[model samples]
Target: MKYSKIFQYAYIVFAVLFIYDAISKYMSNGDIYYPSILLAALAIFIFFFRKRFSKKFDNRDNSK
Candidate 1:
């Protein structure tokens, strides 16, 4: 559970970083960086996925 929370927050951090990277690349090069976009997408997916699990864990804890 602790590790899950860590990974959930990590995903959010990675998502932010990837999005920043994408924007910076676009600003500097006037072109969309596909790799950064893909990474951002994956990071968002993981963030949401872990969020769901975290919510479930919280619910379980509260019910105990």
Candidate 2:
């Protein structure tokens, strides 16, 4: 549970970094960086997946 929470927060941090990278690339090159966009998407997916996983774990604990 603790690890899950840590990873969830880590995903958020990665998302922020990816977004910053994308913006910086855009500002410097005037072109979209596809890899950064993809990484941002993956980070978002992981963030939501962690949320759902945590909820499931909570529900299981409550049922005990």
Segments in model 1 whose C-alpha atoms lie over 4 Å from true places: 57-64
lDDT of 2 at 44: 93
What's the true lDDT of residue 28 in model 1?
A: 98
Q: Please provide TM-scores, in order, for all candidate models, with all chains considered together.
A: 0.77, 0.90
Give the alpha carbon lDDT tens digit for every residue of 8-27 in model 1: 78987888899999999999
Top TM-score model: 2
Instruction: After superposing candidate 2 on the true structure, give the runs of residues whose Cα lies further than 4 Å from its correct spot.
Output: none
Task: Per model, state how many residue pairs clash.
Answer: 0, 0
Q: What is the lDDT of residue 48 in candidate 2?
A: 97
- Candidate 1 versus the native: TM-score? 0.77
* Candidate lDDT values, in order: 0.89, 0.92
